[model samples]
Target: MSSTAQTADTTVTIVDGRVVTPDGVIDGRVEIGGDRITAVGDSDAETDTVIDANGQLVLPGLVDIHGDDIESHLYPRSGARMDTEMALAAADRANVAAGITTKFHAISFELDESADRSPELAATLTDAITDATDLLVDHRLHARCEVTQKRCVEAVIDVIDNDNTDLVSVMSHVPGKGQFRDIEAFRQYYENANDRTAAEAEEMIDERGSMSMATLRERVDRVVDRAHEAGVVTASHDDENPREVEQLADSGVDIAEYPITLETAQRATEIGMTTAMGAPNLVRGESQWGNLSTAAGIDAGVIDTLVADYHPPSLLAGVFVDTEEPLHERVKRATANPADAVGLSDRGRIKAGKRADLIVVDPDPTPTVTAAVVAGQPVYHADTTIEVSR
Candidate 1:
């Protein structure tokens, strides 16, 4: 079955789509040749294939800098490990269906039960990610470094030195700060994982808290240096205040992943940092942890990128958010801005000589994805019929 609506040179053309470019959303057509966008304009040029977007939004494919939805594919219902290849293949299908062409599986080198991103699973997943052949979109590894675990520095350095990590972000998950501020909140995370009882979780949290990453700054420096030496972009995670943001800048961190408060986010942006937020947080209208809203971050010009984070589909959903920002700017936050944040300049925007990564969005009331193209090839076409409104 063809994923495309119509078939024509060896080229593909999408016409009558409200294409979102950096300038603005314009009624235009885009032509693709090989793996790149050949042209985007008012050209009426004939091509081998033509896809009529039917006046729906034609946008650059969502570039997700951090997402771990793939974790579910690994441990479907909790218990033994499945074939890693099978898991990644299934995850990539879901990724393209969500209109995300550039996906960074934020595999953590941390210890956690709820997420399979634990120490034991890191190598297995990293190997699967590196060698997966059935992926429909561009896949990269966003190595989440648990800085407090001094034992894992050599392992992380080895991967970065081998060029396996495309991006690295230093994380400190101590109990008293960032995500686990409240001791009860920390205890609940462990209790819900069902690995430890509340009392056991509390004990573990206290142990980890005493040895926070603040005390391991030297190890953080070493890991950051190794990542930078390998040309992997480094980011700081869960910034809490202006001082932390400033310190991250002084340490040469390329991006600030998620700031806990509005003041922190604003400070990060002020220091010439790329402030990113979760697309899920934006689409859901709030953060799960009751932190600063990504919408508010956007309004204040603090959010430079919106990553898929834990949810893949939220990237596209965030586009239809009712914001005062122009559609083009909002779209860029998910697409071009993230691509650039990760030092990728080849495949974000719709222009001649750029990668043909795009999503045709059905802009009807529901605003679902209709089709997705990656590297000039259609990868996903929605099976549901798009409903028309009166």
Candidate 2:
């Protein structure tokens, strides 16, 4: 067969699967042609490849709205770094195995000379991500700009102007306030994760004392204006108060990431900004950093999307642990809700005319991802019994 014919005729029909759609679950066969879902029903469509799901749950592949943990693979710890390309490939495989088809890697840029915010470093990492996309599922950059880092703002702006930046979040990490207002908590984090002595950690916090509130507001507004003008969505990170939420909303920020208080999260939702809660928070039953409880936010109807955050597996696990509603309802929070919030209207649900980005999961008393497909092509499969011929 010709290459195009081979690809087109390589129809993948998933049979006897409990398909999870935006609406609900149903026993059906999903027929995929090339890169789009041609049909999603029990129509007995003939296909060259068939997945015998055996009543497993087939749902949309996860769209992780924010994931900074990829950086962990590149720079595992302070002063230690790995090959960016190698780190990206490993991260891609890990995410795919966890059923994440689209991932937005959040790369933080801090302008402090003492920090590792090298312009060359950011460009190199961005280039690595762009080059690795061919071998990976959909990958995009979400630049987390520290608004207080005035020295490096120009460099970050240059990267954003490169047309590769898809998302930009305005963040200000001023110690003794906001996300790190509690000095003791900050010390503990640095001591545990960075292997710093308690004295060293305390010194770091004291050195980076809080940014001026007026300056923070101006920086946020400036970045938001530039990002929105470039067609990139803007997000507010670690908002701790209703006023912070209001400021972000006033600036037309599209998303509020990891709001630290229930009031702020509710205010974000009320003002029509999408609220993104970390999946790790849901899986742990609370935020590790003592931010707003994800379960509480979900119950309050303030959470719109679930991000992988620091753990790729948490995205899937969150769907199961979030028990405030039916399982299917919780699943939508991670899948369709995230896709909708990010303006990706195509592949959030299993339906004809949409991109066939989906996963077959074995679910009984527990859930396990068995196969993952992106754009109608099998990218990950746990069942070796099923053979394929090209």
Candidate 3:
């Protein structure tokens, strides 16, 4: 469908299914006009198309605050790769199928000479996001700045300044501490992922270990200052302690990504920073790297939003399995909470004048997406019997 065609609408009625509106689910019809929801009521309204929701649960499309696995598609392995455009297209389709309407691809800028941190790779991914915006679901760039790789900070800042970057995270991945506080555990990560010998991994760590906390603080302050000035939301990655949270709060960081402990997570909340925990962590029952589990953080009232850090589909799955308190309460972590954290006040909730970004999922606890709409456009419609307006 042409972009203009998708945006042109007066009233498209969605009837029957359990409508998960901002207030709560109600059996009713939703009317859409252009990109906004015009009305939602029991009375039938004249419209261009009618979607029989039937046994589905109509809910807001996911607002994914952080997703970095797209890089694996752009550069499949350490060396092997695919075209940037192809990777982005495939990622967009996958995100839509998983019921994500808004995706922030976390592209890292590391100073290391590894192929993953190349400026060329970052630029290509950024360009692909821009080109595919019309053809796919909403896609935005989230720059993950590795403070240890201070040299690449300026290059990433250029991308943010160019206005395509949406979120910037200041991270310090120094081997001996912080996220990987135990040096031996850090060696294990390199050994497992890269198949490098322990000795070789240690050598790499030594060569890359010159960055100190003092230098990291200085560099991160500068990057955060610049990103905030550019109107981009800033985050601190893998914080493990209250001190780290305090430091980030001092720098005006808006979000805290993956706090490593309950103490840090709680500190983030006390300081008014939105804490983002990985959806995968909640689904997997634990953090893969032994960090504080999202469930634990949520129980502590520290988690504000859930992001699909590695697995894109975890966002939907998490909504079903987040068995902490109540299902309705947990749903907010994946939906409205993340939207508010990212300052996207328009698309997260289903209400009049809000963008029509929504998904149709089976009412089952662990549901599969039946259809997805972005800006009133059907991005992924699976009902073969019901014809989608192209």
Candidate 4:
């Protein structure tokens, strides 16, 4: 659905909802003048539009730091690729409908996985992300560099120099390491994902060039330095152990995405690096690749953010997973924590003077995003049941 357009002088108010502010919860209203929240309290001002929340939750829109939903959109079927702009447009609508206002599309720069992930296409997609304008939600690029490949590292550095990426991550998906701790699991995963045989997957793995720790560190340092120079946040992906986390932390990485174990996550947290877990893992109660469980990470207090790794809907579902934590705390895992982690201070909280990126949720039968408003525009309304006075 198309968002309701707004003028600079337009004033929209979300009324009678339980607003989840940074300080605490308030059973009041939120006033949005233009693209910023002008006030957030019981006292309301005259407005051009009114969205009656009907005592539901008025929450800060989710800030998804690392989401790979675009990959599936780009490659919907085997040997089939969709138009880049069209795929991005679809992903944008899907994310906003899932209550995600800010999304960092994880674009992989790999040597030879799928044709869509090649260095050339990666560069093209990076530029596309930077140039796209007709999107529903706030879109940003998270360039995921396969550090094992020198070509991938160089491509990521080029994008960094061009100022195309908002967040950069260094990862090595070599078999028997990081995400693929077991060689058999790696082969199985590749075979299933690509619809290839075990021999083909093994051949693909064997064709990869091995890089030493020193070389890998050098490459990572290059990307990290370039990203820092460009004022972009850097992250380490699929950390396998505490030592790896410490090493990445030493390299000035600000976030660790999807640490493979609890020890790794704890080390990241202790070192003051933000730790993120997949929302699908949390909602499913286990990792798809048999890595650290999101519930386990939350239990250990190591998980700071929930990302829509491959499932946009899981972000909302993961927030309400049966836990001892309060509703606000769970919401923060998907909102404020991620925004703060990525240095996005303008949004993520339902407070005065912040960006008017908000989601209306109903939590009685199940947690559902009834409506989403981004930059003072009504992006998506689930049904006509929501009352909006124009």
- Each prediction's TM-score against the native? 0.93, 0.92, 0.93, 0.95
Name the runs in model 3 displaced over 4 angstroms: 1-5, 111-115, 197-200, 322-324, 363-365, 384-390
Decide which is better by lDDT, 2 or 4. Answer: 4
Model 1: residues with Cα > 4 Å off, grouped in runs:
1-9, 113-115, 212-214, 383-390
Count of residue pairs whose backbone atoms collide, per candidate: 3, 1, 0, 0
By TM-score, who's the top model here? 4
lDDT of 4 by residue, 48-113 (tens): 889999888899999999998888888887669889889888888888888999999888899665
Clashing pairs in 4: none
How far does residue 359 in candidate 4 sit from its true spot (Å)?
0.7
Model 3 pairs in collision: none
Give per-residue CA lDDT, model 3, range 1-390, as digits (tens): 112136464557677767777667777877788888888767666777777777577888898989987977876887677887788778888888898888888887764434456665677777777656355678888888877765667777888788878789888776877678888777887777766777878876886587667888888899888988889899989998999899889989999999999999999999899999999999899988788998898877888999988788899888888465665567678788888888888878778898888788874656688887788866677866434442
Ranking by lDDT: 4, 1, 3, 2
lDDT of model 1 at position 94 = 88
User: Which lDDT value does model 3 have at 366?
Assistant: 66
Q: Rate the local accuracy (lDDT) of all candidates.
A: 0.81, 0.79, 0.79, 0.87
**Model 1 / residue 362 / CA error / Å:** 0.6
Question: Which residue pairs in candidate 1 collide?
Answer: 8-48, 8-49, 9-48
